[model samples]
Target chain A: NAGVTQTPKFRILKIGQSMTLQCAQDMNHNYMYWYRQDPGMGLKLIYYSVGAGITDKGEVPNGYNVSRSTTEDFPLRLELAAPSQTSVYFCASSLLVLPDSTEQFFGPGTRLTVL
Target chain B: TQLLEQSPQFLSIQEGENLTVYCNSSSVFSSLQWYRQEPGEGPVLLVTVVTGGEVKKLKRLTFQFGDARKDSSLHITAAQPGDTGLYLCAGKDTNAGKSTFGDGTTLTVKP
Candidate 1:
């Protein structure tokens, strides 16, 4: 089964442009997250949703927006992209949390470059 | 700030060598996960340690969680070129439903 999938594998945008990174999961996981990884750096959380219609800010939420309106989709939006926003973006999904929650499953990633 | 910090940002070694990477933090974690990532692909889960002082082995790889629940380590025995990749550690976020990832450790194994 396709666990997690991300769209627009690669994109180039001029400054001030807007775009959305699409993410979908087929596992019906309740938790979804968006993260960005810079070259040689660890993944930084951008935004997350615990379930449908529930979104929250994360460590690095600036210049990004997210919506979780369904159990299978969590999309991140970049409005007015900046050079600093150029990075590889990833989406992840996890099953409902308990003391024994499983590890997150990740998407291949979307590479975005802003000029 | 990242909840976890990984050490030895980069490592290079010859085949058949042994190596260890560390992930440390001041906050207590309910669970810590290790992931290995290749170029152009997402990180894949290697193992997850939940109990303090617990050690888990997967083939030639060994993972241990610190007694205090604030640190963890990944040790590779008889490393091969196939083990070269970016290694990351993520800790479950106690304040939320998500987990925080540490800056990854890049490993290069030469044959």
Candidate 2:
């Protein structure tokens, strides 16, 4: 099913630059999430969507925005990049929020570095 | 936000030894998941324990959820080089639609 896929495996951005990280899932999951992993730290959620038109902020949503216009695509936007925004980003999808449905499939990851 | 803490932040062991990684939290969860991540790669789900005191096995790996659903542990038997990676635990709160993650346990199994 190709599960979940993310674009731009590696990227470097200058301070104040902007870009969008793309994520897609063919699994037709109802839930999609964006998370960032700083070096030597646990992952922190940036944003998430429960459905195609429903989006919400997560643990760490600063410097980031998201849009879920379709069931398969959830994109994260960086308005003005900062060194603090440098981290590995992951996209994941799941069927629902039920305990049995908590198994999330993750994309390879997108590594971003801001200078 | 709920927090999860993992123990033995780093470990280096011989290929044939056994190891256990722990995830603990002060809050209860509906379910807990274990994942393995290799360098430059996102985590892959290894197992998910939903019920309190539930136990599951995969190959040489055994996963156990705490009776109160506030903790979990992953044990690997006769570890191998292929087992070297960062192991992570995530706790899910269905009602909140959010999953909190532990920092992770980095394991190095030398051949």
Candidate 3:
């Protein structure tokens, strides 16, 4: 199984440009999440969906938007790219977030650099 | 906001040595997870401890959750070069229905 997969392993963007980071998971997970990791830091929650059509903002959701149109895909959109958005973005999915299911599987991550 | 703090931000040792990394939070958690991340790849789940004082072992790695459920520890026995990477600890807050992550502990095991 591909588990979780992300497109455009790496990309370079200019200030004010917009783009979307694609994320898909084949594990049939009920919960999907988007996170960003800055250098020398841990992953910060960007947005997440409990199920298709049910999305919510996470710890750091500003300047970013997400849509979960299907159970297997969750895409993050950056309306106006900024230098602060430069980081490695990761997509993860878990069976569920109940007390018994907490382990998350993550994708390789997309590296974005705003110049 | 729930925050996780990891100690010994960096560590370097020769193979066969042992090391321990710590993650602490003032706020209680319903469950906590540990992950290891290699150079250009994503983080992989190592273990998860829920109950207070819970202990789980994976190969040569030992994980422990504090009795208060507000802290955790990861100890590697006879570490190998392959164990070199960033170790992160994340906690789930049932109240918020979300998880928070620590900055991470970077370990380098030399051959």
Best by lDDT: 3
CA-lDDT, candidates in order: 0.93, 0.93, 0.94
- TM-scores for all candidates: the values are 0.98, 0.97, 0.97
Fold similarity of candidate 1's chain A to the true chain A, as a TM-score: 0.97
Which scores better on lDDT, 1 or 3?
3
Going through the candidates in the order shown, the clash numbers are: 0, 0, 0
lDDT of 3 by residue, B13-103 (tens): 9999999999999999999999999989999989989999999999999999999999999999999999999999999987755689999
Regions of candidate 1 where Cα sits further than 4 Å from its true position:
none
lDDT of candidate 3?
Answer: 0.94
For candidate 2, please provide the TM-score of chain A on its own.
0.97
Over the stretch A22-94, how does candidate 2's per-residue lDDT look in tens digits?
A: 9999998999999999987778999999999999999999999999999999999999999999999999999
Question: 1 or 2: which has the higher lDDT?
Answer: 2
lDDT of 2 by residue, B6-100 (tens): 99899999999999999999999989999999988888889989999999999999999999999999999999999999999999975877789
Candidate 1 residues A4-83, lDDT tens each? 99999999999999999999999989999999999999999999898999999999999999999899999999999999
- The DockQ score of candidate 1 comes to 0.83
Better of 2 and 3 by DockQ: 3
